[model samples]
Target: MDILYYLQTFDHFIIYLVASLLLFGLGTFLFKWLTPYSERDLIRAGNVAVSLKLLGKMAGLVVVLQSAIRSSINLIDLAIWALIAIVIQVVLHLIIEHVFTRKTNLAKEVEKGNVAVGLFLGGISILVGLIVAATISY
Candidate 1:
């Protein structure tokens, strides 16, 4: 009958976990698909694409962190903020082609599926879970 009740339920946790994973996974995919370099080019240029993508995947840590904060902070507002961040990232990419020094990212080579990135994202999910659990008692 209360939010605490919801938090104790496995279904609630599963739903949150699954949804978070899917969104982060899908976002990573989209970023990869839109990246601008080929494997051949990276090979010829000393693997700059992978390096750059690694940075992005790492920096993307912030996105997942924010999402975790949003999960229990205010779901609706968090969604709106995420949309804004996406727009900003896209715009920044579009406007900075000349300043770019790396080859480009294809999304797949993000450190070979970026196990670290995946783990950190899941960690964020845990943070969300803890926050929800903590808030439930209040």
Candidate 2:
């Protein structure tokens, strides 16, 4: 293969990579904003439950985004789908916090380092990610 040809392809790859990173950052910031409590503060206080939940969200977002990137026909398509995926994730989080755990306050529980709540949230996120990823198609 011609070295120059390989080098030229790097430009588009770099662009895609940068765009993906930006989307990921935006999604994460949005998640923080949507939540009722400060995840950062909870994690700082050594809350393993909060940490696990956050980790799951991050992992889920990446999986969804990876699907969007792989199945997108163009950059614009990727971006649009990414935004949709983010919205879905936020909605899912809300449902988990409010609807599913109606009797219990998930945010409060997580803040108090409840590992059961954290595990549930973490597993839900991963499951959502897989489902969302599977739904994406070119």
lDDT of each: 0.46, 0.86
lDDT tens readout by residue for model 1, 42-134:
545565445444345435534543544454455444444444444445444434432432465324443345545334433433443334324
The C-alpha local distance difference test score for the whole of candidate 2 amounts to 0.86
Q: Which residue segments of model 2 deviate by more than 4 Å?
A: none
Tens-digit lDDT string for candidate 2 (85-124): 9889778767766787778778788888998888789778
Against the correct fold, how does model 2 do in TM-score? 0.92
Least accurate 10 contiguous residues by lDDT in model 2:
93-102
Error of 2 at 107 (Å): 1.0
Task: Give residue 75's error in model 1 in angstroms.
Answer: 4.5
After superposition on all C-alphas, the RMSD of every candidate to the true structure, in Å, is 9.7, 1.3
- TM-score each candidate: 0.44, 0.92
